[model samples]
Target: MEIKNNRLTGATFVEANAYNKTAVMKPDAIIIHYTAGASGNATVKLFAAKTSKTSAHFVVSEDGTITQMVDLNRKAYHAGTSSYNGRSSYNNFSIGIEISNPGYLQKIDGKYYTWWEVKKDKKTATPEDKVYVGKHRNAVTTMTYWYKYTDEQIKAVKELCQAICKAYDIKEILGHEEIAPGRKCDPGPAFPLDALRADIVSNTKKDLNVSELFKDAVKESASTSLTIGRVKVKLNFRQSPSSNAPLKSSPMAADTYVYIIGSDSTGEWYNILYEMTGWMDKEFVEQDNTDDNYDGELTTNSAMLYNDQKKSRRLVSDLKAGTKFNILDQQENMFRIQAVVEGWASSKYITKI
Candidate 1:
């Protein structure tokens, strides 16, 4: 589990069929993904095929075996149309790791099956204990089922990520869903992404520049006022809070949720955040002011809420055990909840009622 000359030693190397042969990238991040296939060998074979357009640096099998499909320094076409932290096109800046998984599953006739397996009436049903049910951050509220990752695979991933972070000074570890939400949901809720990220970053913080990067990120993200608003009608998202302000892009559709940051002097214009930050007319944006809708409660004796999700240490309020809260939103392990206060808390400490 050691990185040597832009490759992992002691891991099987399988040349990928497609990758950027010219451009070499100094990666600062790692993106985790699920194969959505049966095994790591299948994905390895797919990447090795001449017709396959997708490739990744590494793939961890169900039994914890590691296989390297592409060189670490080369750009693998794993992230498509992705963006995160003001950076777009992640393939050029990050290493991609594909884990063997069937991804989300559907239950029918008391048997759990993958999406394709259900259509074929496949008799090989996943064990009940291997299915994880949870709400996706992008989804509104309803829970979804996904295949669980084995402890062995998780252990291998953690070790591999740690080695990469140490060798390349990697700063951020992200899921594919975070970089390309709505379009992808691999390495779903069943993966312990947050814990893994925290563990890796915490151990590498002293040597790497991740601490400073995280601080800057937290500062930038904290600029948002944490006000949720709904678009009342289709209108242009302007660069400024005036009618003469230039539009950022196409008109935002009605019912789109935005984070209201500030407003103009007249209070008729609101600065908001959707896919991008811009100003929208206050009259056309409805602010959320709903009553308490507690569907979860605190399990810990004490838990602190933060104004935003980026800064883990920033405190808003401390709640005692049995404190009821409503899950307004989620980002990784952090839940934007409305409990005694409207702020973010670790989902690890909250259980659904």
Candidate 2:
């Protein structure tokens, strides 16, 4: 955790996008950023790309590996359109540290997923301690989770900050949120901003409690079985109770049997078995004590399979009287059918068996 030759030798130095090209100025502040991507390796490469308009002095991975992108004397184009303490441009007076994080989690239906659509499963998933309401960088406060920044990451950041301050005489350390406020929410609530600063100022090191930071969720309770409901539309089953979670490679079709624990707080996504228990939207899917499995028989000879509801949709295939197809979802007069003839069929032409 030391700086030599004007660079953090512990960090891999690679020049990336250029900004603030004037005579290198001694940076007095540090601006923290989140890569908002899945992995640190991928994010660092993007910064190295000439077309990428962003670059940071250093990047910290989820595993705590550090990569230096630009020299401390040189400015990194990270804090865009940002100002702090009478300073109009931050890059000119600050060294930027990009933290590797799957920035935000978006819940679509009931499942939790990352912005990159990576599924958040219990094995690797960390339940958010408390849901944040109100505007996030102007995003309507949908239920969001605090990413579990690892202890390794925490120590690394502390060490890096200590090293940077010792070498450059930096006066204050701050997050991107403090600088941009409503326009950004990086190094978010999940980050212990106040404590981090305190540790640096007082030089008293303390480790943040992971349990106090992340929600401890037991496995979905027993005595309840959740299966994907029958629906006319295709449903996205995710690894977590968020639509933002990585989608189960295949859409959950109607009548697809799914196991459930319970609905998320929103009472939308129902957990099921996929990559060892994820979430599926409750609307187009469902969870019930009894599995809704049945057979439907066509009553008419000229019945046609459609991509959507019967009358107004284009035909998907043709079917004959006395034909049997497994039911996926059922509407009043149209049914989504699976098997050899997989699509929507007129309910009048089919009878439940």
The candidate maximizing TM-score is: 1
| TM-score, per-candidate, Cα-based | 0.63, 0.52
RMSD of model 1 against the true structure: 14.4
lDDT (10s digit) by residue, model 1, range 282-308? 988888643233477788877776767
The global Cα lDDT (0 to 1) of model 2 is 0.64
Residues 304-339, candidate 2, lDDT per residue (tens digit)? 666577455654345545555568898888888852
User: How much does candidate 1 score in TM-score?
Assistant: 0.63
Model 2, position 297: C-alpha lDDT score? 69
